[model samples]
Target: MDFVFLEDSEWKSLGEFISTKWRNKKLVILCDENTETYCLPRLLAENPDMLSGTEIISVPPGESSKSLALVEQLTLALNDLRIDRNAGLICLGGGVITDLGGFLASVYKRGIPFINVPTSLLAMIDASVGGKTGVNAGILKNQIGTFNHPEGVFVYPAFLETLPILEKKSAYGEILKHALISSVENWNHLKDIGELDEIGPKEIITSMQVKAEVVQQDFKEGGVRKILNFGHTVGHAIESWSIATSRPLLHGEAVAWGMVVEAELSKSVGLPLEQFVEIEATVRNLFEPIVLKTSDLNDLISLMGADKKNTNEQLGFVLLKNIGNPVFDQFIDSEKVLSSLKKVFEL
Candidate 1:
């Protein structure tokens, strides 16, 4: 429940904070190649003694690294490092780092304390704050993860300036999804921002708060939390299928496409046509259109069938009634799903 929003230069403070809070604790830094190169030096310099009694482990960059095999590798490495139950994990990178690091911490020694130092905008707003941690199970996104909250979360906005443009845009997808599901005010606020790259710490804080409020209410995703899955149902499906069969889409990019598809579904299900179009247009403005062939739709539909959100073999969704309002666990007919896909792809 602890989320700290800090300036990019403030990341150096984290070393001191960890030293003071977790005195005598073994420190294991879980980073990706990207963070090791770009972020680790700053962290090490700020806390000159930070590397002492610390084991730095680097996972390969990208979603491909989120696998059971890598988890085993990390687990075995931690064991070899002789980190006991008093050890702490510091996830230092983007969503992939937080997800893999957090999950590893949760399972090692039946659960240990972990901290998140999020570098990417996407991780700052979503993955870093939430305790949900896991690697992808096969083609499915986060099919195996635990709801293990971190001891703390530290977000450094400066790291975002180093991100590639597409990475920032991918992060924007989650922020845009937050506005769509939370409030008309949030949606309108973002519409005024124009470009996604223009989003700053203030905007990041706003998006993080939206998720924080939701996670506080439904930590285990029993009821109200399901609304957070608004775009993820189809989003994860497209992400999983694409990674397994074709070029992989970034998590946020796939989610953006999911919102587009679900927006169409919302319109067909009797949401006010005007509101649906407004939501669609706003999302489209932030992200470019994604092209999915008819064949892709078939694979996507099959992928959706295996989504964790499905119950009793019925594919469910969190669709919008209007901006700031969402309806969860709604089932749509397969024909309607196909029709929506065709509409989205203009097939």
Candidate 2:
């Protein structure tokens, strides 16, 4: 699992690696409409010789593109292009593209090699780094997927320049999650950031390192890696519920809110009130709280039931004993879960 920061001379290394490694293989660049317009040209310009023969495939942008129907269509397109087991896919967009492309490559003809060229901050620090790849099932998030690593992950920080302000802010949710679950020092560094623009390569790399270390220890998420799911359980449910509504939240935005509520849940176990307040203030400072209605609670709870982290019908969560001290696989009763949602969302 090589992670290269494609700044300055590093882009040449990527070109050389592609030229030598995928020279004889058919290469397909998978992106969304957003990346195609803003990123693909730069990629081709930088790796002209290596990617000259590569084919381009662009799907509509956003979370909706990660679906079974699109997978089927993309599969058929690959087949029509005569893509075989040796073919490689270059996922060249944000989290949704990387997740969908990785899943497609993993299952197509019993798997094909792929590399991620993540253009968004969210994908760079989280999705593209981890081996977890999947698409949503109906309204649920990542309900269908696999644990498949990419050939490599090449990140170009310049890509962030093309992202809208909201998109950039969205990534801080995961960034905050990493800091909270890793160490007090990391927390202190991130807690008082005044603007998304204040985040630089150092913050991004620190977040990526946190996740990479966790994944290395638990590639299958049998134990420690579960810590990475700190905010995801409630986050995913809220994300799913929002998907069905007219106002949809970005993945990281939902996760930020989830962390706020889950931090409240942590108090019942051992997380101190002062630490919880610190966590809540940091998250709220970075993201606006989503308005959750009383009517939404039942639907959110039902969605949580479908979470893969659950075991034997009990909802499992990763709670904090303190900032940077995460405890995973804590099962809580549905009643408490409901109460936490009510308390946080003020339902």
Model 1 / residue 235 / CA error / Å: 2.5
TM-score of each: 0.88, 0.89
TM-score of 1: 0.88
The lowest-lDDT stretch of 10 consecutive residues in candidate 2 is 306-315
User: Model-by-model lDDT, in order?
Assistant: 0.83, 0.87
Evaluate residue 143 in candidate 2 and report its C-alpha lDDT on the 0 to 100 scale.
Answer: 96
Which candidate number has the best lDDT? Answer: 2
Span of ten consecutive residues with least summed lDDT in model 1: 306-315
lDDT of 1 by residue, 87-111 (tens): 9999999999999988998888898
lDDT of 2 by residue, 128-213 (tens): 98799999998767899999999888888888889998888888889999999999899988876756888887787889889999
Q: List ranges where model 1 is wrong by over 4 Å.
A: 12-16, 49-53, 240-247, 268-270, 293-299, 306-314
Score residue 3 of candidate 1 by CA lDDT.
Answer: 49
Q: Which residue pairs in candidate 2 collide?
A: none
Clashing pairs in 1: none
